[model samples]
Target: MPIQASFPSQEPLGLNADLIRKYNQPAPRYTSYPTALKFKPIEDKASRSAMLADIEDAEGPLSLYVHVPYCRSLCWFCGCAKIISTNTALADKYLDYLEMEVRRYANLIRSGRKVVQLHFGGGSPNFLSPAQIGRLDNILRSSFEFDPSAEISVELDPRTLSKSQVLAFRKLGVNRASIGVQDINSKVQEAIHRIQPTETNIKTISWLREAGINSINVDLIYGLPHQTESSFNQTLDEVLGYDPNRLAVFSYAHVPWSKPAQKILERSPLPTADSKIDILIQTVQRLTGSGYAHVGMDHFAKIDDPMVKAQEAKTLQRNFQGYSLHADVEICAFGMSAISQSKNSFRQNQKDLDAYYKMLDEGDIPLEKGYLLTPDDQIRREVIMRLMCDLELDFQARGESNGVDFQNYFSSELDRLQVFEEDGLISFVEGGLEVTPLGRLLIRNVASRFDAYLGDAKQGFSKAI
Candidate 1:
């Protein structure tokens, strides 16, 4: 179909294959302004200490992320930095280092700052035994200050998850869970090298709810090898039947250059580009048509979900963990390959396990690369994040916030966006801009317009379809 540039912005998102192909180009995910691609090497240990000391006096509650970099097996589609291991001994050892790192931060971060959010992301947190899970939780609770009602969430690989582990997570104050359910089709699972049975996901979710941790989110990936429109719809059907509170249906990010394991999929007959976009369009129709709000860029949530509430109130935030409720808090991360975010800086821990363990072994911070946002970077960040999360921007009002003449400052960018406006992706209002429903799917492309570093250096990013 040809583009429909004249559609009313209030109309529900409509499929335009022309628009999909036109906007489907590589772009940074913008999980952070300037993105991780722009991060630079850290100078010294004092810079690390200074980062922590800086956090001591910062405003707002703290958000903590724990990275367990060991997975029982490699999932070909995974882009996360993870080690494939079954050694309980390795996790136990890693936990010791993780605790040391956490304690180091705890000592630096004053007790007055309460932790508002805690997340466990992984190779798979489910890879840990029940005791290890408890031990990791105890280390954090004993070291850091936590709000009683904080949202504690964990990412679980259903294939490795157990009822005991879920119970242990509940006991440790985990209230939310994200289970991987990429596809239920046998051929699709075999193609991706993540042979998860549908029953595994079903059983795991049931265990989480039985343990009273009811807020469950399931992740699905479209455009995988051997996947089809009908197969994916069936996968969606099964997942929706799981009755998840929120869902993230991501386009399979095929960055085989960085994650060499993904090369395995090249041997399989993958869906053609046209077929994939058809699946994407149908997915939006099925999800939104089923009453789930298209919660920006591949995420969907029920009408009453907290994420929907946050987006409606314009308090939703996009971070390394995807969309989050906390807006202004500093995110401090633990373990190797974890990235932490503060008001002005982004820092990632050492990605190599040996180096990561070495740093903590010597009582040093495991920082590898960091970036401090410049004033211009900050302004662009605000504009881009507003577009990505809030789905709109008030130029005159936001101009006052950034102390710039919005139209004059972004004049060039505005001129560049004429194509989007013409394509009906964005609409100009009286003194601001509103991203139309169709634009939300391509918000990364829309937001990348404000990125000062986005020109010709977008290496390792997935296409924006």
Candidate 2:
């Protein structure tokens, strides 16, 4: 079906300076509620065994996330754990190790455990050839009881995909494809060292649709070097022309000190904060005006999109994959730097491949760091998830009913959000706090106010724009 497009005629909204001032601070992306930084490594076999036990006890279907951390070339702005290499031999070796890891995990779980979602993300999952992806898919299906209706998704770099590759992915049961279209402007693309043209993207999108893969998602960035309102508008127009099922607009996090390769983007200019804000406002207006329902922070989709349906049913969930239809699936991450979350806690694999391989070879889980959620962590996580996903927190209702007083438990945090209330970003109601539309843009900041370990922790995270 051809996607409908419309632009709202309402005047653009301006940024709330006071809200921006009070909440425009660095914060975790909240891919995990407590954030991975809080995770402490499992020091012994006993602890690891307990963690595995928790995973075994969790009910319902599982989600599998496999990280293929390799790319043919580096996009200077990328901060993911990836290796830039042309060695097909290295990829083959990695595949063997990945298969071994998958088998190891499968052995740990009980029989009849079903996988509801399987995602391949990385420097680029499409970095592997068609046969390799097919091999990986077959391995997963053999090792786990994959639900035939499961959402099998993969992230692609259009510059690397071919027609045969798209068809192969469809045959492998990939129902969704997410392509990166950070910016259509050549100057902006050149600045980020990810130079994909309009035709390349168009062809890829068309090919995916042609191959019976209809759910297309396009990713765009707002704060890249050389990204101006005009450039972004052109990019948006170009992207809308392809009519993707979903759009993810993100703010570029410039952390040169952390991701050294980002230092390479020295010559091209970045939009000013106000200009970046302008582009954001314009983009949001454009998406909504075109009839795409605003699916909360940084996501837009057709009103009938599965994600939108999930949101309306209050079953929508946010995770490392952003918004998802499978909210409660126990995620088992495999590969270097991959993160897994069970009902009780979260665990992460070693960040570096060498450390990862070393641990796996030594008959260990290769977990570098992880946190076992305390009862308090679970409570706060529930509260934060409610606030983030629903844009409202029923502290008195949710807390007191759960045997705790909302104010007493989060007194200091409530005190912190006072400035936001004063700034008209959020409001305190009878038994809950509601995030005003203006506050939605600063949801990460608002959520951070409840973080017990934000400033004290030394781990760096992306900025909340």
What are the root-mean-square deviations of the candidates from the true structure over C-alphas?
A: 3.6, 4.1
Clashes (backbone N, CA, C under 3 Å), per candidate, total 0, 6
Model 2, range 343-416, lDDT digits (tens) per residue? Answer: 78888899989989988898777788877888888777777766666677767655864578878988999998
List candidate 2 stretches off by more than 4 Å: 1-18, 400-403, 455-459
What are the Cα lDDT values of the candidates?
0.85, 0.81
lDDT string, candidate 1, 282-385, tens digits: 88888887768887888888878888888777778888999998787889999999998887788899999999999888888788998878889889988888
Against the true structure, whose TM-score is highest? 1
Model 2: worst 10 consecutive residues (lDDT sum): 1-10
Candidate 1's C-alpha runs over 4 A off are 1-11, 45-53
| Candidate 2 global TM-score | 0.92
Per-residue lDDT of 282 in model 2: 80
